[model samples]
Target: MPHAKTTPFAMPLPDALAHVDRVFGIGTILADEGQDIVAPYYVQSEPGYKRVHSEKGCMHMALNTDGVYTADGYFTQIREVADQIRQVQATRVLELGSGMGFNTIALAPDHGQVTFTGLDLMAHHVSTARNDAGHLPNASFRQGSYTEIPEDLRGADVVFGFETLCYAADLDAVADQIAAALAPGGRFVMYDGFRRADFAAAPQDVQTAARLFEVTTAVTNGFHTIEAWDAALRRAGLVVLRSQDLTDASIAGLRYLHNRSARFFRSWKYRLLRHVMPKYLIRNAVAGLVGPYMIEGAGPRSGDTMGAITYSVLVVEKPR
Candidate 1:
């Protein structure tokens, strides 16, 4: 895959922004098997994702099944997440990029005996998560870069690195940081997108133009094959517990919901970007590009093609 033409000039270059750990673990995550992977999207700046995920319509797909914002469904989904975590028996668990702290709230009961730390890269996200954590007694919010998170995370019973990895340029460091932060016997729960089983004709501009929809940038470094992600996890001293191809299930579901919720899919939120910014420059423009895609007139770059459920999810564990 071709690297981005323009490298970001930020302190923790997007590559380094993965997780803020000063030191790295000794073992390496191995991609012994070669699998061609592609990150579904890109972003020129952080605003790229904030605009779309924060939006009312397009956001449901990103947050609900993808693990972005709080669920619009009900406590059942939250319970499902808790079931996954409780089974792990994580005493000190940390979620890497908790957007609105929904997961934190959902897992609040677990935190009664479980110490949870929710870390986020965005300021508003941290503030909102902190506000969400305000009522919780065990959880705390921290405003820090993933690149330098402290060693306190080293022995966590459950360490999660969800789809948020896609935003990092260097997945190696991301893996290193996660491994270093894990408890010797803890499990590393990972859920990410996978490559399509067959090659779909892609636009040469898929990499560049896709950045127009920045929300995809946060969880997916790019669309990767299950094999590629599997290899990375193994290399980092973690073993795959269970993984399955959910591509078909997710795609089918998104298409169903999208069609069913077509009205909300184009709600007034679609036309209100100008109120927030100049509308020409910023994520609004990207949202405009994504609008048509979500509206059913997809020209290959449609919503069905670029969502979280589009890929498979996995659960990997760090052995004692």
Candidate 2:
């Protein structure tokens, strides 16, 4: 993407304000109760999906089948994740970007004696999750950045992130922190999107779409490819055990979002807001409310069909 043309003077009112608002909105929405995780604005897909999984799509397909959130079967997938943690016999586990602690609450009981420490960047998310998991004595939530896992929190047997690592401006440092936090032979499992190694080789339209997705979603470094992620892990003293591309199955989420956004965009409220709201507020609102859908739309175009992006699950281990 070409650099934006800047004037010799400071940026104008709403433009500068819009930029700040967008950034702040992205950071704060985790705690926004108005957004429902059950029907998250940013709908997520499971690990494996056929062209059409069900009447509603992979999400419903997973839900009806007792599937974990955006993952495969509930029992089987959770068993696998638990088993991976069990491999090291992790009594204490750390989850980065724990969001509302839904995943932690869902998976904690299955592990019996294992304890889960959920960390998120938003304090409200932490408090809300704490309340949500009040019954789960083994699960706890705190606010913190993924870039630096606190010293006291280090030495966890496993560290996992679910679609959260993309927010890191320094993935290498994040990886290093995870490595430092893990016990020898500890595991790190992540489910997120990555740019293809040959993403640059994709068509111009696809390239632009990918860039827009990053900009819209406020991703620090945006999507990464397996090669880049693998290199980062290796540099941080972690070994990549598995990287499974799920781009095809994940397209359903994007398709669902695009359709959903189409209806909302045509609504009178949205129309009024677009034209009547101040430029900064409008930009911030779009970035918070609609930007995710726009970014989701780009997924299939850049990932599933264009081969420029891949949504994948990664399993890595720290050397013993």
Candidate 3:
């Protein structure tokens, strides 16, 4: 893989903090309760995600393996899911928090023999996904929460969630649900931002950036550590197959969004629009700008590599 030309955390920690404070009152950002905000946040953020993230309705970060950001990078997680489907010869696939059905819809057409069901907390998201997937008879979406996978949806050969598991209020509970939902020998895959094991030891600014990113993105309580997830999954009797940090692969895409978000802060017109836009929607800029810092720490000039969060993939299996 080629190295990213754009460096992570190119913006100094102090500068990033000040920018966040200016764009969103620091106190207001900190005061957000984060409770019951997931559905509303997605509802408010749908338009922005469509316009900025991907018109195809991807609600997750792009993984730019080639060191350059492109719309195609959004397919990285989908590609991984496809690989798992093939590996397991998955006849039934279940996606948790399947926002807009991007991954399922993308995979359904190619895997005509597979049946894909997406469950999301928001009806609007399910409706949107269902509408987008109307042409694909193999794909279907319904409004539901991963906290309780429907009995009929259980026994999936492949279960995956992209960036949505962070909103899980109870990791152990969700893990149990996932484990139960999968058949023996089935694979469970997830890609999301995680708190590093040593997150507490990271610099204060980096921690702040991570919190801001989490809250702004509706992960209000903060992201769970990879260690926590590993333990939770294991306790639920799932065997961990892979736990790899892919933060570096995410830099190019983060930088791309950061630069785009920076434009809002740099110009008065964009700043003015923040007042009129939905609070949660406009705050996405704050998340976009500080995302790299949370993952990569202070800039190259400072030589600080102490990061508080990581973008990672976790794959587990229910033993046969």
Candidate 4:
């Protein structure tokens, strides 16, 4: 229920669940841990945001959907929400914060007769995204949370949840659990963290405290503007089709993914594994100055914290 400026953390969520179970498997917990998630501030905030946005801007190493992303190759805004959910060829689909499964294997082979589910709340990353959905076959996985409402996702048809609804503190109970699990007039695509005007002309308030003031994860940011997601989609009955502004194409593909993630973090094989790998360290100076302040300078970036992508992405509809 953390809203009204959520900054409250007494510290410690890492018992590391048996060190994330005797050192991850399931391809390094859904595809590499990216330096044990930047060494602290609970891996850059919000109850370990499912392995930090599924390996923060997964440079397409997110189980190959024809890979390539150095961050902000947000799989081309998840391929325009998988071509509008494969032109609604959906039968049953659901995803709500299925991080580390990278859009549940990039929207599960384009709705393989749907029936794809993936919920999450650190149920061990939904048991490592069901072992990274290996054989795929009408995928399945659940850990529950959207305040737990299963019943075969009611009438599911389409419901993808990106950027995990700004770590929902309760956006009208997660938009009434995506309008009671769609299917009546299903449709619910997403993208999160909206509040623009160039992120309120950046005077710094995008927080997640370790000691940079504080505000770990939203308690209230239901699409902070875009007229607050059209008044939270008419108070969760949903009905907004086609909405885009991939925030200036995600700030020009995060400027070509912060210059190819600073040449893959200064390659010489990752600076010789950050110099003789002590587990390729990271003590976060704002995610190591966010790939060298967005690829080595052009000035004023208000000292990078991944320069907040300022967002919006919608398909929404649910009221037959």
State which candidate has the highest lDDT.
Answer: 3
- Report lDDT per candidate: 0.47, 0.57, 0.89, 0.49
Model 3, which residues run further than 4 Å from truth?
Answer: 5-10
What lDDT is obtained when candidate 1 is compared to the true structure?
0.47
Runs of candidate 4 exceeding 4 Å displacement: 1-91, 96-98, 102-114, 117-156, 164-184, 187-191, 198-315
TM-scores, all candidates, are 0.61, 0.68, 0.97, 0.29
The number of residue pairs in model 4 that clash at the backbone is 1
In the range 1-320, model 2's lDDT, one tens digit per residue, is 21111111122222322343443343343234222232222222111111233221121212112111233432333454687877888988998877666667778888769888999876656876788788888998988877878898888888888767766567688888989999888898887767778778765544544544454444435576767778898999898999886554444344333333344344566546546543332332332233222223323323423435667778999898
Least lDDT summed over 10 consecutive residues: which range in candidate 2? 1-10
Across 110-178, the per-residue lDDT of candidate 1 in tens digits comes to 558888887877676677678767878888877665566677666777766555554555556676778
Between candidates 2 and 3, the one scoring higher on TM-score is: 3
The weakest ten consecutive residues by lDDT in model 1 span: 20-29
Order the candidates by lDDT, highest first: 3, 2, 4, 1
State which candidate has the highest TM-score: 3
Per-model C-alpha RMSD: 13.0, 11.5, 1.5, 17.1
Candidates in descending TM-score order: 3, 2, 1, 4
| TM-score attained by model 1 | 0.61
